[model samples]
Target: MALPPADDLPPLRAVVEAHGLAPRKALGQNFLFDLNLTAKIARSAGPLDGFTVFEIGPGPGGLTRALLAQGAERVIAVERDPRCLPILSEISARYPGRLEVVEGDALETDLAARARGTPAKIVANLPYNVGTQLLINWLTANPDAPFWTSMTLMFQKEVGQRIVAAPGSNHYGRLGVLAGWLTRSEILFDVPPQAFTPPPKVTSSVVQLTPLAERLACDLDRLERVTHAAFGQRRKMLRQSLKPLGGEALLDRVGIDPTRRAETLSVAEFCALAQAL
Candidate 1:
């Protein structure tokens, strides 16, 4: 018998059940099989016509189907789970030339090279465990040669807060500083834990990041080093905590108050300290 039409393909629930594909917590898999939500995410990416979209962890092809339906010129989906490959292939077949599946770890793939041939945009509900690291890698790619023009990705509420957190906020830390230095980030909307197939304990949110035309004019390596040291002891004052990086001396070189804590420092101030190092 001919397979069900791609657009008319069985719901993700049916597909998962037919395949006996329970989401693997170890892989950080929480399948978002809700078509309405997936379509909403796709639409939020905006004007995908002629745009090459890159998706990570397309479990059960919910987001993949949405992108294809929304007129994306082409979509390259990277999936690590071998079990999910067949499901994605069904999507590839349904969409024909529009969908391509790359079965491998997203972290190891060279996304920049993948984007070399097309105008790319990244939209996905990222796996919880490795989402931040993947984002950092993507943002730190050659800034001059941007791979994806923008990112519409999801993260746990706490991670989302850190991504868009401002100085002096309790959520502000290494992630905030780095994200601020690299991109313009905002929390688009919240998704309750119940939205996932196997609900995560914490709420999740969509975060959209557009890389800045120019970097924050600080040494990234040093900035990360300083933030790592400072936030590593978040509760301690700079004089006491930054002691490892030169302590009060380090603050003096940067012209910052030794008594100030990491949370109190602005991104610019943090950048300055990183440069001073």
Candidate 2:
């Protein structure tokens, strides 16, 4: 695909330098100066036309600008760092009504409220420090009715793998089970460490998740409790690990082998166990 034309605003590097913005480790900030990459990440969320995108940790508005340029109907960005406000404001000015910058912790922001009945997509290079928790919050926000149409997020490669991991895989755990129970997820691509302003020690990956129209019938809290216990002592057999819940008797009722380990259980099995509990 042909790269979108850069907006008339100054390059991200210049914006960062002019504003005295340095990628802060404490904030998990790693600015992406590569507009092409940003545009690619925005596009991965599928068509943006007529969609309002909620972006978290839009440091310096690199991805924010890309979303606007790529035809997003609107971009609502939640940024915690006050230092990036001026630069983000500059992008908002360039895009006029298309960009809205919210100055607050994304974890606390009520994204569904901000989306306001519009079709929403979340596209972000999430802050590493809180990326997983943010995703979990979104997934468990409304089990019966997900707020967004899709989510295209960048996370540390290991974390990304866990989101899309399958049962029986080494990476499979609570994250994988929870995500699989809610969405159809896959890793779209890997991003090298060198892509960011301050390179992280590990590579990054972009993962896309589209909510299932109808998720399996299970109590979200119960499922969470079941997985937590099962995977908390992953090396042990289910009979031992799940002893607090019911042990071999529980597995017998569910028809799953008591000797099976947590990693071997499918999302359906976990849901069944939760339902039984």
Candidate 3:
């Protein structure tokens, strides 16, 4: 006789306990066990009826389960931890062909390859240690041909602020300039510290990023170079801080005030300086 259909897979807590998957501090793991919260995050991605969603660091398959139950056409989950693979495998078996768990570091993996030309969106709580770096890498990977339609991601509150910050804000930095140059970003909602199994010391927030059809025509490499020099010594005025890169003369060449500080410059102004360099 055929066995009962896996009991629809027990609650995430049961899976976590069964597999002894306590959140590993080293891995920056903070499992979101609440179905309500996970479902909310899934919905935040807009409709997934015919769309493929990519998830990173799906520990215990909490968000993964939510995505499947929410009617995602397919989910390609990139999980790094070997220990969590078995748990994710169980979810895959339960969900059948709906879930694909790739075992590897997200940073080293090529997302475009896994995408396989499907209409895709990225939805993940993200690994805290490398989330920002991963985002920057993805945005700059092929700015001309952004693969994913949109991104719904979780980040530390400070990082979230930087993502949506204006040019004059203190939180504005290289992240701000890159995010502004590449995509239109906004903070969705804040996730309380208690929302996780092992709460992070600081609060977190979800951010939605949609790439602009056309961005300011500027060389990304040059933009990065300019921002790095400007923000490297943010406290110093442009004249003093940018001496290594041609100083007041450089600012004058770009038609920017020599007395201005890095944080005060708009993304366009930075791009101008990069182009002038």
Candidate 4:
């Protein structure tokens, strides 16, 4: 039977019990059974009338149902856990052409190419262990012509803070520089640990990142090299920490103080260093 738009989807708990699926910690699965919370997250992506939502780890399909019900034109949900495949298949059947379940690890998949030529919005209750890596991959992939229009994702609260962190904060590091340079990121809301099926120890937050229409020209590889070297020895002054990447000579040429630490350097400074490298 065709599901009634998004309204007829069963309660997530019922579905989970019926399927006898217990979220697997090894896979970083934390199912969100609450419709209200899922709907809130889905709405954070704004109206999805013409967007393809690329979701990672749509366990039991809570957020998937929300995305579909909210009128997303299409949703390409990538699942790594085989246990969730049949559940996801049921969701796909309900929505018909609107949902595509790609059975594979999101880390190894090239989602951008799959959605090629089409604008997409990535919204997911990302698997905690792989969430940061996935975000980095999406941001660093052909930034000049990004596949997704925006990304509203869930992450550990600390990771969310790091994404929007400014220079001089403890949270500021390579992630802050990358996100600061490429997108406008903000913490949308906090989702308490109790919200999950088996609550995590730390709280979680939803972060939304919208890419800049124009970004400074910088080679991604060089930028990563510069950040890895600098932040790798973050406590040491740039003179000592950046020794691998030309150290004082590079800082001197760029008008930066070699005595300054990595945590205090602005995103622009990092981009400058990357360019000069």
Identify the leading candidate in terms of lDDT: 2
Per-residue lDDT of candidate 2, residues 71-181 (tens digit): 999999999999999998888888889888899999999999999999999999999999999999999898788889999999999999999999989999999999999
Residue-by-residue lDDT tens digits, candidate 1, 1-277: 4333337878989999988999999999998877888888998998999888999999899999989988999998999899998888887888889988999999999977877667889998999999999988887776556778889999999999999999989999999998898889999899988889899999999999988888767877788789999999999899988887898888998799998899999999999888888
Clashes of 4: 0
The sequence of per-residue lDDT tens digits that candidate 3 reaches over residues 166-235 is 9889999999999998899999999999999798999999999999988788898888888998999999
Report, for all candidates in order, the number of backbone clashes.
1, 0, 0, 0
The TM-score obtained by model 4 is: 0.96
C-alpha lDDT of residue 67 in model 3: 86
Off by over 4 Å in 4: 1-6
- Model 1 CA lDDT for position 57: 94
Clashing pairs in 4: none
Q: List lDDT for all candidates, in order.
A: 0.89, 0.93, 0.89, 0.91
Residue 180 C-alpha lDDT in model 1: 90
TM of each candidate vs. truth: 0.93, 0.98, 0.95, 0.96
- Evaluated against the true structure, the overall lDDT of model 2 is 0.93
Model 3: which ten-residue window has the lowest total lDDT?
Answer: 1-10
Candidate that beats the other on TM-score, 1 or 2, i.e. the better one: 2
